[model samples]
Target: MPLRYQAIGEALRHTIAARPDADALVVPHQGVRWSWRSLGERVDRVAVGLLALGLEPGDRVGMWGPNSAEWVLVQLACARAGFILVTINPAYRRDELVHALELTGVRALVLADRFKSSDYVAMLLDAVPRFGGADQGSDGPCSELRFAIGLGRTVGDIIPFERLLEEPDSAPFAHLETISREVGPDDAACIQFTSGTTGAPKGATLSHFGLLNNGALTGSVMRMRPEDRVCIPVPLFHCFGMVVGVLGCVAHGSTMVLPSESFDPAAVMASVERERCTVLYGVPTMFIAELALPDFGRFDISSLRTGAMGGAPCPEDVMRRVCVDMEMREVTIAFGMTETSPVSFQTRTDADLETRTATIGTAHPWVEARIADETGRPVSRGKIGELQIRGYGVMLGYWNDPQRTAETIINGWLRTGDLAAMDDQGRCRIVGRSKDMIIRGGENIYPVELENFLRTHPAIVDVAVFGVPDARLGEEVCAWIKTSGPLSAEHILAHCAGRLAHYKIPSHVRFVDGFPMTASGKMYKPGMRKAEERDPTPRIPVARGSERAIKERLSR
Candidate 1:
């Protein structure tokens, strides 16, 4: 298949040359739209800047911000300089930002001046002093860290990103070819931490081949093309953004349209229509909100060839509208954690409706997918087991945590901690996260079953189920629901009564308009717990969307 690149940078060089004059990126807010040629030149200049900063091969350079020209440029610069790129989420607070940066041994950081009244420069500088050698290498001389600047209104002391580009072309990237030649498929190319809703974030290490393989394989599965333009509304820090969005674009020589903000459905819609975009890459929430836009139907979204839905489950209804109403090729449902370069399973262009709508679909061509029991024995086909995968998509293991890595990587397969059942046709249906499972009175319950059942209720908008402290059963199921119309505790319990066993039924029902969510759209249960404590009354209309159906349904 003529696959495998020397490194990501080398592959990108060929892409730029093939379409040197083609518009490779469009950043409307920055008034920046660069062709592949110009983008390549800028990448080289940034590489020179990093080299001058004394970056070594395989060293990690951190970028903490949204998807901007500078964000993409920094990643490319790392590739060109043989430095591994580490992307940190911009929406993170002080502690999270600090933990991720230090955990990955980020040698240098490139940040924005300010975004939405938050000054990143001040944020990092203030957080740096408190770092206190939290694994900052007990050895001689901790790696010297510097800040490279990016977009924003102000950056007090950091070096401006533009200044780094002022170097002469001769000094810019004369050795780019040398660095590219030195890289191999196995070289650590990039690393990004998971959202860590459960525990401290672990850096997922992606090699050049792992990333490129995921991109190439997904591109083929989704039938992405060189002329296709994908609207990347998700942040580049996420696996969906980097592996499927950026790396995929590079592999297929496709154009990537970057929005000014992480999420503005209106602006995103405008960008897609304006650029004649052929695909939309986003989490399910983004698509749901976009569909909810009052003027959403007014736009000419018929240009969309296909959609890749991941990060969270895409409701079957959403998939139907995306495919039938939006005039898309069927939306492909993808599944993988940060540990798998973000794509081990993806619905192919030829996948059936059931596979596309109900399951995360089959493993990629080079990947193996299976379910196993607690004892590591493979589960029979059609039976649920812990989902495990082994392939080029599997990460190089979490960064710098040998013990944790050993724990996660068993033999060769990566224990994904996700529960799934594979059908005879090889379609993998993800049932629930292993940790999210609730064991009550010796009965096992998966929240996804309850959540899926709740979604069937016309009044229900969203739902979450978690196991809270229980005196007798060890842990009892508690359900937090967000509804469009009024619904009551009794009504929820009754509906869940027949569909599930008594132990699986949520013992407590809390009605709230909104549940806390992470930037990538996973429900933030910890934050929800905090909010529950502060309010203690989930019975009333809280968030704006709360309706009276709960009370009425119960009164009936």
Candidate 2:
């Protein structure tokens, strides 16, 4: 297929021309709805307003807020104005916020008054003391930061979002069109911060072509059409929501639905039923919670025909229920990270159930995927190795950090740091993260395999397996399990007895209420590993000589 070679602003213009009266955006809780034409007009107004604030092309504008119509408007406005939009996670604290601002050299910031319990205004004041006495639209502590804009309410000297919408006496509407024409598809349009699970977050610079095309392709895989209404409950700051959720809808002329400012299972169900949303998006944890609701059956999710799930592996049981109970028959499993426009592999709508659940499908169109060993040589098919990607979806580089960018992207391919195996048919199965792999007595163990096996037990609801420090063996297998009812470590070991290999059986097991989660709802394995290191609790081990005994039993 030919690539879409236009900038995001141009794409939106074409969408407006094609479907002027169709619903383009809907926020039920906020009582906001805009059709395609009206949404385009709003975006143009914001673009002009931003330019009126003395902002110019290539400036970095930071947006820190939850999923809302204003967030979507800022995204489009930045693209139209030829500014690099920097997305900040609403969950970020003072240090993270400061780091993001410093790293991107953001010239302006737009934020909400608060999200959940976070007093964003207070945090900003704490981070930048100059804001205490600075006038509205004046430079603050950071010399490059020209102004600050608040969405819901004015905070100190920050300009209110409403002011940006007001037409100035000499509005730069003509200049907005000029900038749109000058902006190229390869121009840096956005800088999104990585989750920073390992250390400090790095800004991944993405071009207009990369994001718009990725979203269009992802939407195409789900068979999205103009009539489709997509309910997006994920945080807009993440690529999964902004790139795949918002841009996906825009690319296909589908209506974008914001269930709530933040993720709420009840809100998602209500939005789908009320809006008759045909498409949905979320991580596996979101779907699990929605499925586990006490009154899950009360929601009329019959309208949900297709959707996408990513950010973590989707358990087989959860996938099955999503298909049957939630009526998302065409729901697909997407796999990728923030640096690659967030999706490299996505199960096609026509794929078989086994292909959909057992693998992450094949590489996307115009994208290449390969499994390579440590030295970066391609491994033979069906063997486990690091999954690397090279394509248009790859980011320009980590913003302003060539050293780190060179480390991640070598010879044109981005090292995903994921351990995966590909079938002869090209389907890829992510076994485990390279960092999460366990080495016990020189034998490598993939936690996902064991975790999947452990989940087979009727009492187990969820499981996360990782490596724990061991003096004898470099690392030992440890499992954290969430169960539906009472379960003993002995019972877990017995269940694994003859089914799995001796070395693969978890060396330790701990029952827990739930696993720690990241903002995007994926299991926070790094945090859990740190907690395990601190506690170092004595765990139940396999029966003495049980390994050899189980090997002999399985051999029979």
Candidate 3:
């Protein structure tokens, strides 16, 4: 069924009203708790304040902070006021922060003053020159409507968060008119940027309907209970965390454990144990880190019944360890990108270990996943081709890039840049990105972007960025540069000029005399990657247990 307009806010309101006094957000550090009613009221106040900030409808507001109760409030307020919430990963450096804020032309920024020792306020201030410049430019960056507000610290120059509220004492708040305004099902509510296959960061504009329906459907598939405490250590900036963690929990009327800042394995363990959290919601890196802790067995993590494993492939060992070691009931495998509101397939709990460990599972309800040839024709099951998905969760399109959006979303389906295959049981398993896309610690990067930055170096002739398998990060970025004259890693890195973000920068730089090419003179990127993969000098040193198991099965 097609959702009526305002379905997202309506869902939130209905859930809040259902149990007005029920706990909505829990903060262990602050020892604070807010009921759904109170949360809604706060959201209303924030919405009213946002409207007062001179923001136009559809303006992008950068929610740049660690996960907190206020984070959820900001998102709700943005949605209610018809603002596009641009999520900012708290881990980003000053350069990254500046680019994202300017690229999206963020009208208002919701920032945390400090997370741990990292001061986001200082970072934003340093980047203010670039960000401020964008606002004045006729065709550069900032929207006509743009400004910033602080969340954590009441520092000099930055607006304090406490003052963002209009009149907290007021009931039902104002901006009901804004809420009642005509909202289209296609109006963008959020802009999620992914490093595109073409090596440009393309902002995927997801509508209110896309996000709300995706969250609701995912929760339904997982059979989330209203009483469950969903422990979320992932940053809400990412689509996985926002839709699956915050919105999904809200859709199911579940309580959210909102930690004040970025991830700490101990903090997560403590939060889960303290809250008796029923679902462990985080990336595979987080899960692995938690299990690697010496005190892992002592952390009473039985509260983590089951949850998601994606962003990067969850190895069979990781899956088994989560089930056998962490005691999770079923660790569901997922596959998607920001373009699809971040979920295309989720492994069924009933599937066998191979299916659970290997495939990304069947297409999500209301979604169709198919492996198609270059011409967009479907290939037979078990044949590798580009994976395409058509669904409600798919974004409306990219922001401000109609041509790129047209290339990505043809008709109703999204052409995911991932190469994949459907099994006999119709489960989709991702083979690789169709192009040179690298996912390092769940941050997608296109090789061309990095190569373009690298090529600007006086010492560089040509550079190619590719993914190298890593034990911890799943994939680490490796750049093979053919130097014009001569260049050291230090020299090359120094010349980056803060143009590329740290993740986008190369972790391993290999200087080569020449790169192999086809007769047409195009670089054989796969051949280069293959040669490097076969080099065998720096092995990734994966645990041999899963290797042995996989070998045994193949032999059978």
In terms of TM-score, which candidate is strongest? Answer: 2
Best-to-worst ranking by lDDT: 2, 1, 3
Q: TM-scores, in order shown? A: 0.91, 0.96, 0.76
- Candidate 2 vs. true structure, TM-score: 0.96
Off by over 4 Å in 3: 1-6, 116-118, 129-145, 155-157, 166-172, 177-181, 196-198, 437-556
Ranking of all predicted structures according to TM-score, beginning with the best and ending with the worst: 2, 1, 3
Scored against the true structure, residue 327 in model 2 reaches a CA lDDT of 89
How displaced is residue 320 in candidate 2, in Å? 1.5
Residues 139-213 of candidate 2 have per-residue lDDT tens digits of 544567768899876756788888888875543777788889999999999999987877899999999999999
Q: Rate the local accuracy (lDDT) of all candidates.
A: 0.78, 0.89, 0.73
Backbone clashes (count) for model 1: 7
Task: Find the candidate with the highest lDDT and give its number.
Answer: 2
lDDT by residue (305-352, candidate 3, tens digit) is 777776655545556788878777666776677899888798866566
